[model samples]
Target: MELYRSHVLVCAGAGCISSDCQAVKKSLLDSINRLKLDKEVKVVETGCMGPCDQGPVMVVYPEGVFYRRLKPADAVEIAEEHLLKGRVVKHLIYQTPETGSAALTFEQIDFFNKQTRIALRNTGIINPESVEEYIARNGYQALGRVLSKMTPEEVIDLVKKSGLRGRGGAGFPTGLKWEFSARAQGKPKYVVCNADEGDPGAFMDRSILEGDPHSVLEAMAICGYATGAGQGYVYVRAEYPLAVQRLNLAIRKAREYGLLGENIFGTGFGFDVEIRVGAGAFVCGEETALLASIEGRRGEPRPKPPFPAQGGLWGKPTVINNVETWANIPPIILNGADWFAGIGTEKSKGTKVFALAGKVNNTGLVEVPMGTTLREIIFDIGGGIPNGKKFKAAQTGGPSGGCIPAKHLDVPVDYESLTELGAIMGSGGLIIMDEDTCMVDLARFFVEFVQDESCGKCSPCRIGTRRMLEILDRITKGRGRDGDIELLEELGRGIKAGALCGLGQTAPNPVLSTIRHFREEYEAHIYQHRCPAGVCKALTVYVIDEEKCTGCGRCAVVCPAGAVSGVKKQPHHIDPEKCLKCGTCMEKCKFQAIHTL
Candidate 1:
């Protein structure tokens, strides 16, 4: 192997790619080559480095210097000054506004320090496209060990002892699910990996597939072995082209190495995995729906009682685990079940990967132990809410989840605790809400999402979500009546209880949780015709506080509507009739002059 003095890892995850990290990578490589340091230095493209908000993110290993929000020119500077001159780029160093200090190592950064990377262990650390790199990091080791040493029943028993549960939102015991398929008495058993991550702010599954596809492939092979399965399918979202490209590559490599095709490790246990890309339907996240989509049927949820384990994927006993859940299998097998079980809460074992987005200072991906408190995740890890804002609530589990209010900030983030607070651990989309977030609007937003995503196979989720959304719409639009709140509660409960699949069952979660937690906000919107967070346009009117206005034309210049009128260096006034309630004036005003009431 050729030894290099420096290995610069550039984030090639979708988030950083969106921020144009590709250009930054090219610029850095070009500059390095021009400086005749191509042999001395190497640039490697890796997946997400956690702190997504700071993208495009790059790190220089050996020194472990983290560079955030880099421009193409900045990469050139690092290649020249930092790489050649052997001096750190102090200006490009990552510094938290809360700490007011720069971090030398990405590991030492608060966003990563508080996280325990299990499923994401190899994500940012290695070149994901290479099977060799994955093998170097102990990938496929568990599959080999299981095939050579453990029996199918023994493997299932080990997983049961590990207390590992499905990480794809629903907290189903993984080993039990495996056993159900193993003993279902079918001709052909199948293992289906759910990579069709459709949550709005969620990219957890996609990152795993992109950065460490082999791990998932290895885990699926293990599942195939344990469950007595010969064939498997990975149901991935078609929107994730990068993940698809990487997964396809990984699958090819695994098959070439004889890990995927047949008789893996020469154990006569034949297994193969194929990628099945979904057409970006949210309801397909349900197991049966995902199976249906994989079988070339409509992406709609099927009623349970014959759950996927008994009759799934062409009427065969199938074990379906999400990307995160499958990724955890190898570690549990290698480390022993007890080791895996000890990391998390008694019931919900192992760590959870959350797409930590919205309103938080450090918006990125986080993997914390099951019992990690919201306080640790939000403040200690996330560096608290940005711009000195107070956290009002957090929405977990995407549109299918509910709100966690300030009172539950100290609560443990396990499945049971979040469920008690009226939230499910639905695929780990944790959206933070600051004081400025309108809870009523938040509820409406999620309700609307669920309403749109509903497959309409069931009446409760289809019509009930629509009714609840209409009520919320009326409340936000200042046409709310006295009985609107009660009607919402009734409709939300009805939907939850009567809906067909988990999609419909959890459709009303956001509305119910927001009402349970921030009922006062709802009451204000309904009874008093006011939005406490000043978000509802119909209930909100932007006014210029004459006492604080300095007659700066900044607001007037920024406002699309000619609402603000002021002379230079004098008090300004806003015409309420002309104000669009867009809050653009307030955002532009240097002085604290704009008030919403």
Candidate 2:
């Protein structure tokens, strides 16, 4: 085996890849070869390192020096100065928000250090393409242990004791689901991994698949063994090309090593997996809809009671869990159920992986214990809202989620606590909002998303969500009625009570939750015909403060609507009718002269 003195791990996750981390990697390789440092310095492309905003990022092992926001040119500097000369590149180092100084190691940065990482243990640490690295890190050890020592019933009991609820929106007891599938009378049962992660800002599942494909494969095999199944399928969306590629590779590697296919570990248990790519339908995140898609049907939800555990995938008993939930299984099997259960709250066990986006400083993948508070996630782990802005709200669970206002920042982010706030832990997409955000407009945006994505399977979700969207549209456009707020509440309740599937049922969450918390904002929009945050173009008017206006003509030049009127070195004036309300003037005005009314 070739041993290197220093290991350089570059983030090749989808985010970093889009940022052209490949160019940075090429530069590093060229520099290393030119300097005769290839033998001593090793460069490996891994998956997400959590801090996505800082990509293309790399971490140097031995010293564990973390580098962020790298360019192709910067790679040469890191290779020569940090890799060859044994000197730390201070400028390339990650800057700690608390001290505003360089944090030398990965642990020194609070973004990574504050969270627990069971589901994401192998991510960003090893080369995902190489199954050898995954094996070296005890990747398939859980499957071996379960197959050799434990019975199917014993495995189910262990998971039950672990207190692991499904992380895929519904938080259903995973063990209970397994037990149901096991007990159900069916021939040739199936195990399915729901990789159809359609939440707007979520990449938790995609990252796991790209980073640690084997963990998911191992977990599925374990599920197959427990459920008396011969075949398993991964329902991944077509959008994740990299994740799909890695999954296929991992499946081939597992079969080659006899970890998959017939007679695994010589115990006569047979299991194999296939990839079923989805067409990016958001509703397919629901289990039945996902199963429908896997069977090459139009993805739509069906009424339950004859749930997936009883009849799924060509009318056979099946067990299904999403990517994050499946990733947790192997760890529980290896570490023991009590070990997993002990980490989280009484009802919500283990850590949750959240894709933290929007106004927060640290926007990335954050995995914390289930009971961690929203304040800790936003302020401490997320490094708070950007540019010293006050946190106004957080939108969790994508379009089906509710907005958590500033007052509820201290609420624990467990399943029940979030449900009480009218939010479901729907696949962990947490988008932070700053003080300048308009609550009414935010609600409208989410409602619009859900409305567009509705499969039109049922009238309540199809017609009711459409009604809610129309009302929200009117409210945001300064054309709201007197009883519009009350009507919205009524419609939202009707939809929740009458919608067919989970997606349809939760469709009105954003509107309802925003109304529950920020009723005053809705009143301002409806009664006053004004957006408090000045987000609604029809309700907002741009003006210039003559005292602060330097009149550099920057706003005038950049304005698409040509609303700004001013000469050089003179105070500018804005015609509200001509203004597009794109906020270009405010963004370009260096003197801080623009204000919205």
Global fold similarity of model 1 (TM-score): 0.97
Candidate 1: RMSD to truth: 1.6
TM-scores for every candidate against the unseen true structure: 0.97, 0.97
Task: State the displacement of the C-alpha of residue 36, model 2, in Å, after optimal TM-score superposition.
Answer: 1.4
Model 1, residue 440: what's the lDDT? 87
lDDT of 2 by residue, 278-307 (tens): 999998999999999998899999999799
Task: Give all candidates' CA lDDT scores.
Answer: 0.90, 0.93
Clashing pairs in 1: none
